[model samples]
Target: MDIANQAALVTGGASGLGAATARRLAAAGANVAILDRDAAQAKRMAGEIDGLAYACDVADAASAEQAVAQAAAAQGPARILVNCAGIGPAARIVGREGPMPLADFEAVIRINLIGTFNLLRLAAAAMIATEPQGPDGERGVIINTASVAAYEGQIGQAAYAASKGGIVALTIQAARELAARGVRVMTIAPGIMATPMLLGLPEQVQQSLGDSVPFPKRLGHPQEYADLVVSILTNPLLNGETIRLDGALRMPPR
Candidate 1:
């Protein structure tokens, strides 16, 4: 679907990959809404991009519902929904502190997996109510962020990997269910990116991580991820699949 003049809601749009996607969509003439738990950062980013900023905790049903309503009220129902809000807390089932708290695992699942589904369901419902945009009867497109951990999780990534694996599984099935309604679902399993989480590390640490990549030997830029998102939104036939954005890096077992 053409992003021009259409509405888009990007969760975790305050920084990192989501921020890059929001800017790209805005540059493409879409009315964008930046959704994130960081109100200040969201507002700042929204101001810079000339878009709406919504403080939202995607993990909460009520919060997500209200944010979506507010966004729709501002720019009409969003036809493009990008689920980039997620947390990656590395922890083993049994850690140095003994067995990991069950709540810790649940927390990751709540934010990464359930939160993704919550926004997808709400956004798809809104998109379904809108008129088809093209000859293909396309109403909307959805892009979700998963992780390479889902496939090759390291030593302390059980919770993170499980949450992302769930996201990967949800992609094709959700796409099949939404196909009849002219909505598309796709997932991106990013290996390693120079996001805020990574940038915060020491330069040596960052370099070490970059060297882990097979060919590029560097972390992916947020813009790289954003570009793929643009491609996914424009390509009518790309749906119901999880695309890995890694640079041929399968990740080592930590």
Candidate 2:
């Protein structure tokens, strides 16, 4: 769909991939909204993009609902929704500490999988209410972020991988269900990228991670992910799919 002048909502827009997406959408003439748990950062990013900001915990139903409503109040219902809120704490299912705390697993799932679903449902409802645009009867598009670990989870990534795996699994099902409503659903499973979480590691560790990619031999850029989002939105044929943003890298089990 044409992004110009359309309202776009991005979760976790304070930093990393979501932040990049917000900036790109704004540049493309979309009125953007940044929803994040970090209120200060969200506001800061919004200011940079001339967009709306909302303090939101994507995992919380009430918080997400309120944020979405507020965004719609300010910028009309969103024609684009990008779900980038998630956690990636690594822990073994059965480590020396004994089985990983059930709470740990639940936390990852809650923030990643359930959180994604929360915003998706709210945005989709609003999209369905909007008049369809273009000959394809397009209402809106939803883009979700997953991780390469969902397909090849390494040691100590049980919780993170499972949450992302759930997102990957949801892509086609959501797209197929929402198709009749003119809302498209898609997921991007990114390989190791220069996200703040990954960038915080030791220099050599970062280098090692970059070298592991099969081509380009470096970390993926958030902008590249945003670029793919643009591609998906504009290309009417792209739907109900999970595209790997990896550099042809199938990770080895660690």
List, residue by residue over 1-254, the lDDT tens digit for candidate 1.
88899999999999999999999999999999998999999999999889999999999999999999999999999999999999998888898899999999999999999999999999999999999988899999999999999899899999999999999999999999999999999999998999999999999999999998997999999999999999999999999999999999998898
Taking all chains together, each candidate's TM-score versus the true structure is 0.99, 0.99
Query: Which ten residues in a row are the worst by lDDT in model 1?
Result: 87-96
Instruction: Write down the TM-score for model 1.
Output: 0.99
Candidate 2 — worst ten consecutive residues by lDDT sum?
84-93
RMSD of 1: 0.6
lDDT of each: 0.96, 0.95
TM accuracy, model 2:
0.99
Q: Mind giving the per-residue lDDT tens digits that candidate 2 earns over 1-254?
A: 99999999999999999999999999999999999999999999999999999999999999999999999999999999999988888888899989999999999999999999999999999999999999999999999999999999999999899899999999999999999999999999999889898898999999999999999899999999999999999999999999999999899989
Model 1 spans > 4 angstroms off = none
